[model samples]
Target chain A: MATEQKDETVGTGTLGKTMAVLEAVALAERPMRFTDILAVSGQPRGTLHRQLTHLVQEGLLELRADHVYLPGLRLLKLASASWARNEFRAVAAPFLEALHAQTGETVHLGVLRGREIIYLDKVESRQAVRMNSQIGNASPVYCTGVGKAALSTLDDAALEVILSGIEFRRFTPQTLVDRAALLGELEAVRRSGVAFDREEHEPGIRCVAAPVCDAARSLVAGISVTGPAYRVEQEKLEAWVPLVRQAAGGIKNELDARLGPQR
Target chain B: MATEQKDETVGTGTLGKTMAVLEAVALAERPMRFTDILAVSGQPRGTLHRQLTHLVQEGLLELRADHVYLPGLRLLKLASASWARNEFRAVAAPFLEALHAQTGETVHLGVLRGREIIYLDKVESRQAVRMNSQIGNASPVYCTGVGKAALSTLDDAALEVILSGIEFRRFTPQTLVDRAALLGELEAVRRSGVAFDREEHEPGIRCVAAPVCDAARSLVAGISVTGPAYRVEQEKLEAWVPLVRQAAGGIKNELDARLGPQR
Candidate 1:
């Protein structure tokens, strides 16, 4: 068994395995079958089945007629409540929508969670650029524009911790595999108040992103506008950078005004 | 205690209480303090506290710095996973978006869950009409457009089962309170292939809704276009009924194409 496998089973027992299996189902691009979940999760067949049964009983997962597992209605209800009150997101939505309207390109809002960045929300562009669906997907924090933008806001020590935790597996030739090079790029982002993907994560796709902060000067989230490299040319990128930064400023302003002197 | 209160406490023990308290938090429009959760849940303070603690440990709720409870990341992750696999909503998204763009009105997609209708996805209008944020909020099936549209597709036996479950508390003077009246309206909807909420749920709001059924002719979901009565006048409503039905047809076609001869 792998090193992480030992930890999932170490005294955590069924609860840990349950969570692991739930996550596998949640993270899959589609509803997962028992065999599909078994392939991704290292848990034994009997254990996984037991976990699925308990989860379904709790109204956390629904076993569909097709025998695939889907996130349950109860979970959807809770998420809807969260989405309603998600401060940064609620305030930033109109700005993101406007940006999408203005540029006719995809707009994304993501927040840092542990060492990875997870997309919290997105306004899809009619164009359907090379990027896959972004909502709820987590990506490495060293390559994507939103990731680097958030990194630009982190202090050196915090950045070091996050950078070291990343796998640094290169998805494209432009992906930064070295910590030093990534730090240098983040420095550029810090100075310019913007970050660019430069075909770092995927070919034929590029993005410009900026980090958002609250009244407390804490980096709360990042927003990006992305498009195909051919359509979003070098000069167009220069144009979009200021708009992305302005949107971050707008979100920060709304946060400050609505939150009323965050303590 | 009320009759429902006694039922919630019936043989279920702490597990039932835990779910009740968690639901109180989930249903709140904003993060709730202990007192807020207690006020709505009717659970004893001590029991509610213990349940909250256990839930926090289980990664279902996060006690925030301000001492209010919010849905935790785990819940959000699970919700996102569900959103991804919500086949009807996913397949109908482009059609809904197009309908919203063409009509310049808020479009709602909802699925029938038990006795209520739960909005699965929405294409928000720039107009910001009288509709309260609809996603995740389940509404009574007798007075709302989407609700009646879904009801129209159900067989008499299923419709009877659902109608008997409604609380029938009137929210507006126009709201349907009598089962006979609601059944008559559903009959009209069934014949017309669409339903209208003529300010029956909320004053000043009107919607034209249509049912989306799968290849099996079972009602899978509904879509509606809602606007203020002044803007979506009775005459204008006539024009929109066909459009809403067409959108429902589009969703049905998409669902059929995607599910591939649903076995």
Candidate 2:
């Protein structure tokens, strides 16, 4: 048992606070101590300890002989099992690798998280101008290629909710800040079965994206190919659209097969 | 909140019962109701609900709108993060694929789990004589190539503890059950840095494995290539020893760099 003082206040309910501590641990670059978690999560000592104890007993956290904590094997087992069953990753990894090999461009996989898009995976090209993205990195959902691909799957009500919560920030000259403009783009994405990020997230970079939907017709995730503006021109991107869409379709098909018709 | 009927006869602790419920859900292969968990875990309603509430709060489990329970995104996030950080997968995947491409044999990455060896990752070859060793599968630590590679890392006392716990059930003719004999073989493994399985766990399958050690010289994991016994004879396995060792070394170097010299 370990003890530490906590000064910062957290208001996201007891369960939410517990989740915050776990998230803090998960996001850490290394194993952490009780004090480190307290500092990062800003939760009171008593609350954090109680939650951690429960987590330890549940095997979600491992308490080493040195009293430092790390994510436990149980969490790893659960995660691996889930990932093994994930249709999206199974379908997309080979395709993404193929896309990278074919065009010498970086590939990305992402899913919506609140008003942001969380990157699930990325395959970097062996070229000099590599696209900068990392697993677990998050960016605004209204600008990135993967973001529009996912947004195109949602109904108007769900789309409205996401748009309402976001404080649209401009990253470059091409970023869409207005709700109407973004909605129009999403509509176009729905019609085209593809999405585009023409330097919307980062200047001098462009990406083409497509949606992966489960058998339930619900959007699960998105796949994108990104490269320099000079290499990935309008004509070149248009030519690759079918490939991207085919990859997404293949993933959806796999997901449906594995998950038994999704919903 | 999910609930279970308590068993007065069994003295399993609250945490243990909670783990049992989660394990039951995992083993069932689909979302389960409160009644289902109660039946499987054999815990009282009050205790089960409290445990489920805690687990759900921690994001280890999720309750559907219809009240069925399933593993949650938190599990996926933790697993993916750990897997991404795991050096064995990063280093071994390419080499394993290369081995498969060269020899048309199944390749495996395994680590010691208690007294067993669990496959962390695997790449199957296109050959018709395929083995059933899939990722997440487990085998006794004394019988398989990867198992012996991992077991060779333990000190005498730790080895004795593991040996003492084993039922020593023989799987095949080559399986080692005698403690003294196993110890001598492990000594050879430590000196030579390789382990072999001549159909010890499965008939008609032969494997050659090499130890992957971190910077601190502790065994992190093992990598093995398996093929039909007729195709992978003593002389051929001897030839493969260098390739397996080199792959293990490559993975160890990457692991050391990524995991910060390993504890």
Candidate 3:
């Protein structure tokens, strides 16, 4: 977790320290016990206990009868407000729906966050066999279609910085195993205005993606149409390239209109 | 807002002060300015500013170019984890889907918190028109179907506390005007084993709801099938009462099986 470095950045303030403890619980793969959180947060047992108690009292964390801490319902209330207030997601909604209707596949909208991509919104396929992506989860930028497409929109210096920091852990045989391979693929993505994930991120999932840019041509986010590799044949995936690109362009156009040309 | 009372509960601790500011931003109807947050949090300018800066840096709050604060992307990540870790929501998912399919309407699963109901999950209808309720948003317990249904499961003393705290803010003409009216309905709800929202929370929105209880017969949550009044006739909505009740029962059964009979 990047939380170790994040802890250092926050320094010694009580608020920052408390937040670090909260993040430890929030980001855990499962509900954490007191000792588990203490290990991750590296805070004194007494301090961590007090922080956890305060968090529970504030409804920021829920301590179940099972003696494990989980994210509280209040987090959802706060997140609902966050999701509703996000102008980018609001502008992209209809476009996402349109794309989902046209493709009959899952559609994802994600933005670059450091070396990872944070999914902002998604439209699930009506079909039973759909991609199992959840909104707000982070994925590697070096292998995923949406991530690489977003990367292709960055200036060279920014791209280089991210690229240098990337630690490519191969998920599938087709995964680009190094920065050089990813750099080469990004060149093709920039030229074609799209990116492809040929089971690079997962064993059976593939997608066609394109970056959405603002009026200034700066990357705002990326959109993708993902499906099972067996069902989404190479020909069918290629056919979706233009459709995905158009949807990305459409979102950008709408955002530009809403925010004005000067923005 | 209940935040002022909540702030008092947290005392003058730095962490509490910081969270109060974060909550002020999180619970705002719109993005809040620094002054707006300061007014609500009742902190010194420098302390509030420092807290805001710290929160922004930690990704708990985001500052826009226009100098307004909104809940940050990190909140979504945390809330997503919280949602995934919620055993109640996980157990109810398939039942919710079945109810949505059976009724051809929006399905909501919510748990009572103080005087409100926090929606845990939703299965939206495939119709051209749908309910605007988001998964994480809270609705007043006395007014919403799910909320009232859950409230029916609470003991008289527990129920009285929530009823006394309610402000009875009327959103529509059909809303229960006071505690006595709501208590009368809760008594009826206990007998019938279901609750109805007849354009109570919002004009034209109606639902039939049932409470889900644990093996020990304590309230776990509530489930409801909601739709526009025009699209859902009174006869059709009444017909869904059994289906909604069955879904709630099924969710409770599954929870009992998964968490073990002792739980």
Q: Pick the candidate with the highest lDDT.
A: 3
Model 3 lDDT per residue over A27-121, tens place: 78877998888778877789888889988877888887778888788888888777767778888888888898899988899987778888888
lDDT of 3 at A95: 85
Candidate 1, after superposition: displacement of residue B33 in Å? 1.7
The lDDT of each candidate is 0.76, 0.71, 0.81
TM-score of 2: 0.70
Q: Each model's RMSD to truth, in Å?
A: 4.4, 6.8, 3.3
For model 2, how does the per-residue alpha-carbon lDDT over B162-208 read when each residue is reduced to its tens digit?
A: 89877676888887877787788888899999999988888889999
Clashes of 2: 6
Q: What is the TM-score of chain B in candidate 3?
A: 0.91
Q: Model 1, range B1-263, lDDT digits (tens) per residue?
A: 45254423333334445666777787676679998887777767886787787677666677866688876656666676677667666678888888887788888888787777888777764422212245666777888899999988988888888887777988899998998899889889989999999999999999999998775644357899889988889888888877888888887877777777656
Question: Evaluated on chain B only, what are the TM-scores of all the candidate structures, in order?
Answer: 0.84, 0.71, 0.91
Residue A197 lDDT, candidate 2, scale 0-100: 95
Model 3 C-alpha lDDT per residue in residues B1-263, reported as the tens digit of each score? 34454344465366667777777798788778989887787777998888898888887887876687888788888787777667787778888888878987888888887678998888775523222237788889989999889888888788878777778888999999888899999999999999999999999999999998775543457999989999998899889888988888888878878768445
TM-score of 3: 0.91
